[model samples]
Target: MQGDQASVIGGAIEFIKEMQQLFHSLERKKKRRRSLSPTPSPKPPSLAAGELAAFCRSAAADVEAKISGSNVMLKTLSKRIPGQVVRIVAVLERQAFEILHLNISTVEDTVLYSFVIKIGLQCQLSVEELALEVQHSFSQESAF
Candidate 1:
């Protein structure tokens, strides 16, 4: 019985040592991965002020046109849509800028332009979706 008890204690210690080694191994792997991964740029790539202004204007104009054309959009909402679109574009642009800087060594003008275009399109889609929801809500309210 004494010998059996000693063996059980030894087995537990062996298991604990194995677990410790495994934890250390995983920690080492995590450190290695962190070292190998590309670090984010200290500062995001600077967007030219002129280019940014041009993009905002173009995006706002496009949103205005869509809102104007939509029969279901309320006049008040239509007035606000362009400003909202600009805000959305600003947020998206900041995120995209960070992501671009992190993923690529250098950002090109064309790539930035394309990202802006995509952000504008996304904002347009969001506005359209909001319009649809508003229209549905209005229709439902009218029914009662």
Candidate 2:
């Protein structure tokens, strides 16, 4: 009876050792997987846009008419700012009258993405004027 009991104890010890080996192997595999995984990167802000040339082409007739026509008011001319990334607050026309939040970059060249948001009605708004207004607004706000 004593011999049987000793053998049973030895078998239990062997089982425990096997379990420990398995646990260590699993831990190593987990570490390897983690090392192979890619680190996450911060994402840039994204905006949807129509191409400048394409938008111009689509709106060409209206643009030409406005340019040639003597009655074109600045308010009506305010909508044509190129490269203007607009987050629309409201849109009144397929080609005009949009309430938009403009994003203009000041960093220089394509690196900065220079364009400004403006509210426009009737004909398209002028890009240069909107940019000036936005810069002014930002300066004034910053000063205060």
Model 1 scores worst on lDDT over the 10 consecutive residues at 103-112
The list of candidate 1 runs beyond 4 A from truth reads: 37-144
TM-score of each: 0.26, 0.25
Question: What tens-digit string does per-residue lDDT give for candidate 1 at 12-115?
Answer: 79646634543453354346446996543222224344321111122112111022122111111111221343343344454332112111111121111111
Candidate 2, residue 50: Cα displacement in angstroms equals 76
lDDT score of model 2?
0.31
Go through the candidates in order and give each one's C-alpha lDDT. Answer: 0.31, 0.31
Listed per candidate, the RMSD to the true structure in angstroms reads 24.0, 27.5
